[model samples]
Target: MPELKTPDSLETQSCQVILSVLYQLNLNHENNVAMSSERRQFILDCLQPSLRQRLISMITYSLNQDLNVTCKLLDYLFDSGIPHLDLITRRFSSFYFPADQVPTVYRLLSRGDPTSLEKLCIGIHLDHSEEGDWEDEEKETICWYSGVKRKEESVSKVLVYNSYFYPTLEKMKKLRHVVLHGVCDNQALSIIGQSCNLLQYLDITGSSDVTDVGIQNLVFPPAIQKAGRVNLVNTRARTNPSMKHICTVLARDTGVDVTGCIILLQFCPRQWI
Candidate 1:
């Protein structure tokens, strides 16, 4: 049977309904998440592509807006069916998506559809708190969040230090365009060069940590680019919003470039593939 295109208002309503249900179910099982996962997947499966995209966009906005949504909620969405991102996320500020073994979590969720994603744009926060409340040595974990929320909302910031991003980046074999802002450290950049070998365009505008060393990895691909090997492990971690975060989310507020203020990026027949 052919699917009917959902109307604008109806699609918006559908997204609201799905979000409300997921939020409720998400709260019901804090400990045994699998139960909600099953239900969430059912919800994900029921929606048409249009409705699904709306829901994902709303969640992404809420996440970047410093709303009440928590890290656990993101996990439920992921554990359920790993919602297809309308955009690959250039404003992942708060780190509310689950932190430990994030690469692994990505691996598992994508098991159902590995090539579902292509482009990836990310911004990892690297600044410290202004108050200087705690000694650098004493502060083992910097908050991934914007720090505007209650202290309890924050999570450890070891993701960059451990540098487990490459595995996750590698998982999406068909990945092409890549964008890194703020957080892409040298190590992360180096691995991205190694893992996402088939990339067509890479933009690392604000990724202060990446220097010539990292850029070289992509520039000279033969030594690092694996011809066809596309496989990896998993990990997960989670955050929510602020100023540096604010600008990015706004730039990507809508799926369509309504204002014609931004340049669209696309990739074609892999010249290197």
Candidate 2:
């Protein structure tokens, strides 16, 4: 990492003071305390344009590997009106956001460059509150690429959970792996099946809206590229006749793993021989 250049005179002093507070808070984050939004903004307002960018870069790159710090920094960036979209998408692996805050994320992306969106690994943070329970105590949030590389050639994996609106998949043509929790519906599954040509690994949990038709589209399609694994658990997709046949064909013909689709486990023995 290159050394950070300090601003001249009072600006340098102000930056040092803010950075000291930020670092102290980061180190003691176990106390679950955070800098107030107003305080962060005040410090930002005091810095020069170049200094602002450097400060943002310092927070992001300095704690990219520390989930707690990264989450806190990301939240600050989101609230700061300068998401630095290009920097985050290119350098960070995952992001978590409350369901209501999702639109802010999209808006930030819209205002910035979209060139790096295709190559970076992206994941959605499922708000645990969607289930009608939210704890008063602060909980640790995690981004999907917590353990993966920061920079990669293409976005190979995505995790979505309890999302209200389906994502537009037109830009994810190179997607290879996906994990959907309570977010896969007939329309969304159909869109993914048709557009994501390189898709292979998929895990869908708690998708009550998916049915035989949606499940089938995942295999036989204009964009069919026989998936390596299809782990379907706790879904309401029917486990009868036609769906069984498709699973059988995918397993026996294309070698796709459908054994994890618990509903079809019985049929696997009969047809997969």
Candidate 3:
């Protein structure tokens, strides 16, 4: 019988072969279940940081096309602690809060480690069905993380909406752009007007609670008036009377510009009139 010998680099070669086969199988019209599982475990076990990062990038690119792959890649990243979280944040534009990973993501944010997050976008909706209703504790956790006090030095922009209006505005004095999609009472508007003076762009859209009285009360400080661009679209102040008030205020103001106004008076419900 002829002697059988395995090459010294057989293990490394096997790993590469498995990875190549898995890559091809993933691209095929139909994936091989057993082979895919074996390759996935093998790739994960290899524990190469570069490989992990590449996988995350590939998975994120395919997120809209293949959620399953995105989820799997997220699982791998979370498990492996890919070290460079910047890729994860960049890849996941809309925060991906899988039920199992929500706590981990929350912890990462709440830890007050600035480097943990590169970008943050928070969306709050009155309709709970759109996303899970944040518990008071979770809300507070999110508020704490989203607050400007905790942001990493690398963070440049923070886009927030919904229940986020008050807490986020109150703390994020460095914010450059803000969009208030839901209702904002007089108090909320005042808080923003007073705190976020550095804001450059602001959009108050679909806010039924913001009436002409509330709009008139929004006295931007000199700094904000000089630098900010304000947009009031589809709000209670969309009526001719309310718009006149807004125009009068803008005209009187020095620092702000309300040049592009999309005031739809016909859409203003009778209740507002």
For candidate 2, the TM-score is 0.34
Instruction: Supply the global lDDT for candidate 2.
Output: 0.41
Model 2 residue pairs with clashes: none
Q: By how many angstroms RMSD does model 2 differ from the true structure?
A: 14.9
| TM, every model | 0.52, 0.34, 0.29
Residues 199-236, model 3: lDDT tens digits:
34444543333434344335433343345443444243
Model 3 RMSD in Å is 17.2
Candidate models: Cα lDDT each: 0.41, 0.41, 0.37
Q: Which stretches of candidate 3 lie over 4 Å from their true place?
A: 1-168, 220-273
Q: Give per-residue CA lDDT, model 2, range 39-63, as digits (tens).
A: 4566556655456655655655444
Model 1 TM-score relative to the real fold: 0.52
Candidate 1 vs candidate 3: the TM-score winner is: 1
Task: Count steric clashes of candidate 1.
Answer: 22
Q: Which stretch of 10 consecutive residues in model 3 shows the poorest summed lDDT?
A: 247-256
